[model samples]
Target: NAGVTQTPKFRVLKTGQSMTLLCAQDMNHEYMYWYRQDPGMGLRLIHYSVGEGTTAKGEVPDGYNVSRLKKQNFLLGLESAAPSQTSVYFCASSYSWPPGDREGTEAFFGQGTRLTVV
Candidate 1:
């Protein structure tokens, strides 16, 4: 329990609804990311933050927003839910980027949040 943790393991959301996914890490990592997993596509980054109070858009940021208000927490928000947004969300944290030559610096992932939009 000293790694990444995501809230609400499963949820069913109606179209046009809104929700926020919470990701918290206790490892004091400098980089945190939010990713979604689809059937055909693998994990796609939604948003990421390099440090506290700083965030950047990732591959699929159209229907998502992110905030890193604290060093240990990263939040992903959906303004309006859609069927296309339904996917398994994963939160991760890493001690370094690229992880080059770093044996123990690989990103740590949560169990994932399964969301269904109908």
Candidate 2:
């Protein structure tokens, strides 16, 4: 099964242009997330969905929007792309955590979507 796949592995965009990055998973997981990783800094959450039909903002939700229409897919949209948004984007999924000890959930990552803005 395709655990997780991201489209347009690499992209180039000009300022003010818009694009949408697609993410798909076949694990039937209940949690999905979109994050961006820049040099030096660790992964910063952009958006996440706990389950199908629900989406929420994360630490770095500015300039981005996400949707979880189906259980296996999550989409990240960038409107009016800017150079500051250039970074490696990753989509991840995980199984629901257990009640008390919920700190061990490991995120399964997609290869990554690299975008460059000029």
User: Best-fitting candidate, measured by TM-score?
Assistant: 1
Please list the residue runs of candidate 1 whose C-alpha ends up more than 4 Å from where it truly belongs after superposition. Answer: none
- Which portions of model 2 show Cα errors greater than 4 Å? 98-105
**How many backbone clashes can be found in candidate 1?**
0
Clashing pairs in 2: none
Output the lDDT of residue 90, model 1: 99
lDDT per residue (tens digit) for residues 36-107 in model 2 = 999999999999999999999999999998899999999999999999999999999987753224663556
The C-alpha local distance difference test score for the whole of candidate 2 amounts to 0.91
What TM-score should be assigned to candidate 2? 0.92
TM-scores, all candidates, are: 0.96, 0.92
Please report, as a residue range, the 10-residue window in candidate 2 with the lowest summed lDDT: 97-106
- lDDT at 5, model 2: 97
